[model samples]
Target: MNKPIYILGIESSCDDTAAAVIFNSKILSNVVASQKIHEEYGGVVPELASRAHQQNIVPVVASALKKACVSKEQLSAVAYTRGPGLMGALLVGSSFAKSLAMGLDLPLIEVNHMQAHILAHFIEDDSQTKPDFPFLALTISGGHTQIVKVTDYFNMEIIGQTIDDAVGEAFDKSAKILGFPYPGGPLIDKYAQLGNPNAFSFTKPKVGDLDFSFSGLKTAILYFVQNNTKTNPNFIKENIADICASIQFTIVDYLMDKLKNAVKETGIKEVAIGGGVSANSGIRKALKKAETDFGWKTHIPNFDYCTDNAAMIAIVGELKYKQNDFSDINVASKARMTF
Candidate 1:
């Protein structure tokens, strides 16, 4: 067997400050420090996220190393999220990884935050099996909603994407209109269980082909709530569950419709989902149903891997290390990047 490779991954791409240590394709430890401070603001403040990352990065990395029972000296390379996130947040991770790599005389590997969400499936774990190459990937999260054709590790094509607000934004924004707190996606999911998905109807946008647009749905929800609460006053309280269920169903239906189309267009039966939104119960059930309903195989990562985490970054790092794909010390964090 070849010598085991150890990669230290750092991810501060958004509000979560995370670190992980992977050895020989297996994760030893994964640590994420979530910023609860953003709750009061109803959304992430870039400046605050950066400051929190600065405070948490060191301890988070140290905690990961300790949990992994691996020391920094044994690491083979340092991997960090390079972009498609807030500039300040991305810089905190990239800069930390670069400096650590320099001090350790190790190579630096840059990972795309979006790609990390997809590559997360490759992380060695006993419970889950990785999808084969050339599979279809649906990446849905707060920032992105995309369908990708994965031909290989690091070889991916965006087959479809959202033109406006992503599905997560739809969920959160809809919840806000319902008077829910920030990070209300999970709350919507929780309330949706007892409600009727068909209780209300929202118009799905007529975006062409596989492209998606949730801005219209968001506006519709806003107007519906405005119109209903005008006379009833307690409309939201009376029908919160039904409204949430309806909204969640609408979004999931839109996503599933496009995913079915992507499968038909590509003739790829292997379907997989990633990113934070994949954790939704409704979406998970839809993907599971596709297996029997449409004769397609599906892959869903564990809940931990679904969100923005360093283990995903480490998996990509390991793949790049095998190909000798290393980034120079001068590499900088990008707020907007592709693939």
Candidate 2:
């Protein structure tokens, strides 16, 4: 802990293969190799994702080290994502990290991908005030959705989660129905700017407290389009922008509603969000608006930090290293990890 702590972090949990170098909490280099193969299929295919990671990891890590102007011998520890992602993808990063750490005689830190997403807020801008203990976090991604309570650096409790489809999944599916290309959530946000959010009303699903159900909302959109298009064949084509806006509004409202309720129940003022959907413009706007409306402090990672990246992994690794928390080579990859 005396010398400047430098860590090498690897992240290949899903489609993106990433590596980063961090000196203490400051990120030196962050490199991500995104897979373009998934674009043809509308979503990630596990086998293909693994193959892509295999091809990307080594070069990604080398580039990160070069960019950071650091050599392998200077690293104090090696870190990699160990779970809550595609099993094959996780294995690629975990195995590589283990081998590198062993060869370098360095400690190994296994990080939870979701936990890294939350900690990403700390990496890019060290000036941002750190969230207080007992802060509430909302993590929304394509595969997962949950409300978490962070009691400490490594202690987290899941208090609310999706009973069915996640909010990001709903957004992508709705975009598909609208004939947008794969990874269409961002496109929806773009087109929505040209339309009115109140142009149409979509009913929010009635799910019990703390649990979210986006399946019903997806169904409603399907039926609404089916019935309306039957009477007016050009309905979707003519009102695409408005429909996108309306759908985006409903989804954002649902997320904010649950977050508000979580704050009310937990009685915690510090709030933050992480994961891919956290990059949505609507979500960012709503969170900032809520700060004034609800009189609560809010924290959000930058756009790059919000999505899958390795800077977050480096930050989490730095924390684990300080606590002497190390992972064994026998640690295995997991597809679904719980807090």
Candidate 3:
């Protein structure tokens, strides 16, 4: 058997300060310190989010190590999210990883936040099935909504992506219009279950066959609510469930339509979804139905992997570690990156 490799992963790409310890492709422990303060502002305040990461990074990492029953000495490399996130937040993780790797005299691996979401499936867990290579990965979250062609662990190409607001933003923004709080995407999903999906209709955007756009749908919802509430006054309260259901269905259907286009374009039957929004019950049900309805194989990660967490980063780190792909101490954090 090959010798075991331990990698320490840190993620502070947004409001969550997370750390994880991985043994090869399996995760030993994952710790995340979420910034609840952002909920008060109705959205993440980048400056505040970074400050919170600075405070949580140390303890979070310590907790992950303790939970894994592993020491810093056992770690073979330090992995951290390097880009395509809030610059200040990304720096907190990248800087700490660099310093720790330097002290331990270990390899430093910088991972892309988006790719981490897709690579998260490779983590050896009994509850989840890993996707095959050359599969289609639909990454949907607050920051991105993309369909990527994954040919290998490290080789991925974004075949389609949102031109404007991401799907998560569409959910959250729609929730806000309905008087839901920050991080309201789940709330929308919760209420969507009780109402009729076709209660209201919002026209899907006329984007390219593969690309996506949600801004128009968001505006349509806003106007619909405004027009209805003008006379009814209690329109939202009276039809909260139906409104949520309709919105959720619209978004989820739009996503499926795009996925269908991707599958057709690539001729790939295996599909996987990652990122925060994959936790949506509607999307999950849709993916499951597609297995039987469309004859496509589907993969969904556990709820932990769906959100912004360190396990994904650790998995990417492990993949890179095997290839001896190390980053320099002078590597800088980026606010935007592409596959």
Per-structure clash totals for the candidates: 0, 0, 0
Candidate 3: C-alpha RMSD after superposition = 0.9
**Which candidate, 2 or 3, has the higher TM-score?**
3
RMSD of each: 0.9, 1.3, 0.9
lDDT per residue as tens, model 1, 38-111: 99989999999999999999999999999998889999999999998999999899889999999999999999
TM-score of each: 0.98, 0.97, 0.99
lDDT (0 to 1) per candidate? 0.93, 0.91, 0.94
How displaced is residue 298 in candidate 2, in Å?
0.6
Q: Write the per-residue lDDT of candidate 3 for residues 1-339, one digit (tens) a residue.
A: 966799999998999999999996889999999999999899999999999999999999999999999999999999999989999999888889999999999999999999999999999999888999899999999989999999998899999999999999999999999999999999999999999999999899989988999999999999999999999999999999999999999999999999999999999999999999999999999999999999999999999999999999999999999999999999899999998
Pick the lDDT winner.
3
Best of the two (1, 3) by lDDT: 3
C-alpha displacement of 317 in model 3, angstroms?
0.5
Given candidate 1, what's the lDDT at residue 263? 93
Model 2 lDDT per residue over 1-339, tens place: 578899999998889999999996888999999999999999999999999999999999999999999999999999999988999999999999999999999999999999988777667575455677879999999888899999888899999999999988999999888888889999999988888999999999888677899998999999998999999999989999899999999999999999999999999989999999998989889998999999988988777787788998999999999999999888888888987
Any idea how many clashes model 3 has? 0
